[model samples]
Target: MQKILLLSVSAGAGHVRAAEAIRAYANIGDAHLEVLHLDVMQYVTAGFRKIYTDFYIKLVNKAPALWGYLYNSSNDAQADSSIEKLRQKLERMNARALLKEITAFKPDAIICTHFLPAEILSRQLKKEVLNCPVWVQVTDFDLHRMWVHEGMAGYFAANDEVAFRMQAQGIAAEKISVTGIPIMPSFTAVASREQCAAEFGLDGKRTTILLMGGGAGLGSLDAIAARLLAMEGDFQLIAMAGKNEAALAALQALSLRYPGRVLPQGFTDKVERLMACVDLVVTKPGGLTTSECLAMGLPMIVNAPIPGQEERNADFLLEQGVALKAFDAVTLEYRIRYLLDNPSKLAEMSIKARALGRPAAGQQVLDTVLSQHP
Candidate 1:
């Protein structure tokens, strides 16, 4: 059996989800390949993990302009030194245990879904501590400078644009491939509209709008839902408040207010099933969720993406014509009505989205890693 270690961090749910998706797809394609998933936080203390995650959320939510400034500033040539400093910091905190765990696993290959592990493992390779191939899957539409590292066996990008970014950052063109962000297998196999309606208690003939607040339910979803509810249209709305109890409760109350027209769902494992039937998705442009929407051929309404990576992702979506951005409740409602009023325009965006979606990204990533290792 070929053992593969999949390293991810829970800084955001996207990284962990991407790692799991690749592992699942690899098993489906090659039963003999054994993939082990590890959270990079395991190397550090719980306090460290909490502080990192909390600081990230606070920075994005409370001081997005500062985050954007830092994100942009880090893209300069001086960022190399910053990254080295970060690696050294991690080295001082957790590198020894992480290296020990990796060596003990004796895996044929290591794959990282987050940059932290990739950088840490790169240091190991440089130090001649672990002798195995290392691969990284960049889980976002845009490549951050922090993700660039030397000594990777290969790197998987969401598109050719990201691959070019990687090459420009000194990675070899041959080492990078444009495989869309890896997503769950459920996204690859979509149900028809009628089939989805039967399964989810939705109306097949009515326009269906999906409102999602991302994994941790981090957005102004309640406000968005109210605005959409006030809009004049023949539509059914499905709002997914992922892991946010307060949001789910609020949406549930709204469902009562709207009767059968609104449906509220809590954190769910069935996003693909819902995506399969939706006419459009109103969401924050997180990499993994937006990729799933694209795979389902659903056009997106992205409103005020958290600065830095999400803003960059929204920009890419807008450039590709698969999504429309509305930063406020009024504009969001206007965009929804515009799409609902013009089926032809919605259909065109769906076509563009489908053209951009790569449903087989997981399988492609697995194949690339295995081919390089063998």
Candidate 2:
């Protein structure tokens, strides 16, 4: 058996979800491969863990402009080598036990869904501590300089644009694979809209829209939901407040005020099912969420994406004709109204989304790795 260690950081759910998706795909009758998925942050100190997980969320939510500046400023490999070296040293120190896990597993190959482990493992590789090949799957439509390490055996890109970016930055074209971002297999599978609608007590044909602001209050689900509810249309809304209890409560109140029209949902594993019946998704274009939308062939009205990889993801979606972006509530309202009033445009967006979706990406990543290792 070929053992593969899949490491992810919990800086956001996307990394962890991407790792799990790969592991899940491997288990679907691929008995020759053994995959272990881990959250590397759990091996570090609580304070360090918070810096990786909580600080990122707080930074983006509280001070997005600073985050954008930092993100853009760090995109070049030559831009901040010294500062990055210092951070990498800190990462290796805080994440030393990650080496212990790798040693214990002694896997044939390693795949990292997040860059932290890849950087740490790259350090170890220099000293011949771990001799196996390490690969990286970038969990976004855009690539950051931090992700462009020297020791990777191969790299997975979400699309051709990112592949080109990697090559532009000196990575060999042979090492890059355009596999899209791995999403849960459920998204790609066939789901019945009528059944999903009945399960959620929704009308299957009412020009429904799915609204998600992500868990971190990134796009203000409450405010956006209020505006959408106030609009005049023959539509029902499914507003998802992912892990945000306050947002959930506010949405519940909206449901009361607009009974039978507004469906309020908290964090759910049933997003694919809810997505089955909805005609459009108004979302903050996080990488994993956007990939899921694409896999479902759902048209998107991207609402105020955070100013970094998300904005980049939105740009790609817009360029591909799969989505339209709205920077504020007024723009979002106008765009949604326009789409609802024009069925042909929405249908076109859905077709484009499907054309761009890579639902089998999880299997593809596994196949690429095993082809080399086995």
Candidate 3:
């Protein structure tokens, strides 16, 4: 039996979710696979995690322009020295512990869903401390230079354009494989829309809109839901407030007033089923959620993406013609109304979305990792 280690961070839900999807796909029972999902912050002090998470939330909530600037600056070659120094500081603490763990596991290969782990492992290989191959599964459509590192065996990208960008950045073309972002297998499986609606006790004849805010349930959800309900249209709205007890309670109370028209769910494992029954998705553009929506052939109305990677994701989906973007609650309401009014346009976008779906991306990534070991 062979061993493989999977690593990810929990700054956001997408990274951990992607790691789980890959783990589910690589269920080699006889291979003695051990998936160690780590939130790199956990290895650090509580102060460190608090500072990092708070900084991220502040950037997304208040300083989006600055965040966008910082994101763009990371792409500049001149910033490599400063960024590498910061990486070294982080690596010294958690990276040392991670290396010790990897040494003990003696895994055939290390697969990283987050860039931090990949950076640490790549540094280990560069220093001749670890010799196993390292594979990185980038969870975004845009290839940030931070994700590109020396000593990496290969990169699994989300699209051909990202692969091209990686190649242009000195990574060999053969070292970059365009396997779409890995998503849970459930997203790929087809569920009868009528069946799913019936199970949820939703009206099958009216269009259904799914409102999500990633796993944290942070977005302009309340405002958007109110506007959605106000529209004089024949549509049912379902809001999934993930792990946000307050938001869920608020939505639940609101739903009572609306009766059978609105449904509020609290942290559910049935997003795939809900997605199957919906005609459109209104959410923030996190990589995992976007990939899941694409897998389900559901067109998206991107509400507000965070300034850095998520903004890039929104651009990718828009370029693919599979999604529309709205910057605020009012804009979202208008876009939703437009989409619902034009079924033909909605169907066309859905067709393009289905065409772009890479449902077997997890398996493809697993195969690539195994090939490197073999």
lDDT of each: 0.85, 0.87, 0.81
All candidates: TM-score: 0.95, 0.95, 0.94
Q: lDDT for model 1, on a 0 to 1 scale?
A: 0.85
lDDT of 1 by residue, 252-354 (tens): 8888888888889998898888887789998889999899988888999987887789999999999999999987766777888888888999999999999
Kindly indicate the candidate among 2 and 3 with the higher TM-score.
Answer: 2
lDDT per residue for candidate 2 within 163-252, as digits (tens), equals: 999998799999999999998878777679999999999999788999987434334676777788899987999998878899999989
RMSD (Å) per prediction:
2.2, 1.9, 2.4
The worst-scoring run of ten residues by lDDT in candidate 1 lies at 214-223
Candidate 2 total steric clashes: 0
Number of backbone-clashing residue pairs for each candidate, in the order shown: 0, 0, 0
Which stretch of 10 consecutive residues in model 2 shows the poorest summed lDDT? 214-223
Ranking by TM-score: 2, 1, 3
At residue 14, candidate 3 shows an lDDT of 80
Q: How would the candidate models be sorted by lDDT, starting from the highest?
A: 2, 1, 3
What ranges in model 3 sit over 4 Å off? 28-34, 77-83, 214-219
